[model samples]
Target: MKLLEVKLLTDNLSLAEKFYGKQLGFTRCHLSADELQIEMGSSVLIFRQTKEIKKPVYHFALNIPNNRLNEAIDWISAIASPLKLNSQGEIIADFRNWNAKSIYFIDPIGNIVEFIARFNLPNQSTEPFSVKSILTISEIGLVVNVVKNTVLEFADRFALDIFVPSTSTEQFAALGNDEGLFIVSEKNRHWYPTMINAQPFPLEIKFETDNNVVYNLSI
Candidate 1:
């Protein structure tokens, strides 16, 4: 299974445009009154308008170049004050982990957005991280009410291979496919979806299969 896109609901289009288009530098692939599509390399993110949505949502991560990690962090800080940052001003840069640097921010809809640069990628020397240096989306977090069932469904339907389960202190499950990785967890978990002045709930994730079949998961 390969991830092609992920869709979420937002009531504010102007804010979406500003954050994703202006701030994040994601290209506008398609747009309409009810929906807006942003391109991240080969992946797509769709934002739809909804009036009934009111629940917390999971956060997602985008991978950039390791060298540009600081640049990405600086860019994000210039636009939005980060909710959390290390002493080095990165969202997460644990050298012991993957030696990756990352920053986290909340969109207008409360979705946790991340810009990360992994150490394993080849283009780590580039400065002021450009979108082209992004290897791929490393992870999309899913904070839900159930983990086992959600993992089973993703594995059964999307062919998501479970790479890691939440530890005793962790409440997230990470799944992977050919395209990238996704993290799933319950609402009770510590990592709650960031709300953009609205409630967050289960959302749909759209992706394409190996056969080029486009499918969506509404959880």
Candidate 2:
């Protein structure tokens, strides 16, 4: 599925604005006083303010030039603090299974932001790494009480292809192609890079299929 937009809840709208606008350098189009919309390549990330959402946080990743992972990491570290593993003390990691390199960072609003470079994808940049180098949002955490059923439902409804082959969906499953992935996980489970517990916070996902069919997933 092609991710056209992702709407996430945030506790503070002003803080989210500062993080995406100033820190991440995303071009923002204010939707309203309570909402901020930032352009992430071909994708739109909408941050909606709500007092009802308790401890609003999410894990999402953006695609970057495959050869510019280190350079992009260096540039990002100057603006935001990167998340480091307590065990190895490494900020950048190699996902050999996906043939991708990734670096994690915490946004001002406490969302885990990832910048991953997939070697299998085309990297046409010979220029400097900047915010413009951020391609599309390639992944987003999908928290559900039942992982297997949710994954199957999403795939059936959206006609999304499972990018990662999984034998047991009881724990986790990633649905969709390399362009975008729903990082589905069981509720209350610990997320990667940091051991933050997952919560089924409300979020809206709008995406288009290869045939230009648009679908909305609200949870």
Candidate 3:
């Protein structure tokens, strides 16, 4: 699956635009006074301005070329500090079983942003990594009240399957493949490598499966 568009909420539009457009080098188009759309490779990341008092932050991951994780890290480090993954001061997260490596960073709005490189994927590039190296929006965390129920609903509604059963549990599940995944996590569960609790806010995702079937999810 591929996430064609992901809509999220934000309270500050100027900062979001400055970070993604000016600093990160992503092209952004202002749809309206309340909406901003950013182009990241094939994916469109949208931020809708909200009047709610509490800011809605989320966790999302971008897929990079299979062999460009290190180069991505170097490129991203110039703009934002790469988050440490462990007390040992390691920045890179090595997911051996998944054949992937990832590094995290916090956006200006406190969103847990990740750039992941899946070694198992055939997408590799000889060019140096940059904003253009981003392949697509691969993952978006959906904080739900019940993981199993959400997983089942997505599977039944979208004809999706669990990505890796062994990597899932009662509290968390990943629906879809490496190209796109809905990370369903129980509410209040701490986000990995951070102590922030997962909280559900309004979000919308438009994605297409490998068979070219498109689906919309709103919550």
Candidate 4:
């Protein structure tokens, strides 16, 4: 599945507008008094107003060029502080189990955002890494009540593959391929290397498949 757009909540709209538009240098799409859209290379990320946000945070990821993970890290560090591991104060992580490396950082509104480089996937860059090196918004947080069922529903409908199959609900489940995924978990989990806990929030995702099938869904 290819993630095309994600619409979720942000407590501070002005902060996000500045973070994504000015600081991170994302291309702004159409904007209104109440809604905003920013282009992230092959996909778009949207932040919409909610009536109220109880937790006001989420975990999401963008795909980065596998060959330029280090350069991508340096480029983002100049703008915002990367979230570091407590023991080592390290900003980058190597998930050998997934054949991936990731750099984590909090956004202006405290969302645990990540730029993950899945080496097993095709490295689609031949130039210097920048914010433009982001290939797509490849994952979104889905704080749910049942990890297995949620993943099965989407996988069955979209014919998507699982990135990691959770052995139980106590663990997080990621469903989809290297292209995109829905990170689902029922546990009140803190984003890795950070104390910020993810909350259940309304999110809408629209994506297409390799067979040219499209799915526009809300949850």
TM-score of each: 0.77, 0.94, 0.96, 0.91
Q: Write the per-residue lDDT of candidate 1 for residues 91-120, one digit (tens) a residue.
A: 563534445566777776666777766565
- Top candidate when judged by lDDT against the true structure: 3
Which runs in model 2 stand beyond 4 Å of their true positions?
29-31, 165-168
lDDT of 2 by residue, 79-123 (tens): 987888676788888788787889998888888889999887896
Candidate 1 runs further than 4 Å off? 54-56, 85-90, 95-99, 123-127, 131-135, 164-170, 177-179, 192-200, 208-215
List, residue by residue over 1-219, the lDDT tens digit for candidate 3.
Answer: 899999999999888988898889885555569888988889999999988846787999999998988889899999999998878899999888878899999899889999999887799999998888988999999999888888788778888888973378888888888888888889999887789899999999999987899988799
lDDT of 2 at 118: 84
RMSD of 3: 1.3
| lDDT value, residue 87 of candidate 2 | 68
For candidate 2, the lDDT comes to 0.84
User: Candidate 3 — which residues are off by over 4 angstroms?
Assistant: 28-31
Clashing pairs in 3: none
* Stretches > 4 Å off in candidate 4: 164-169
Tell me the number of clashing residue pairs for each predicted model.
9, 0, 0, 0
lDDT of 3 at 93: 91
Residue 11 accuracy (lDDT) in model 4? 67
lDDT of 4 by residue, 1-219 (tens): 788888878767777888888888876555667777988988999888665774378788999989898898889889988877767687778878878889898887878889999988897689999777888998888887777777778778887666753233455777776788878867567767776666687888898877879899898
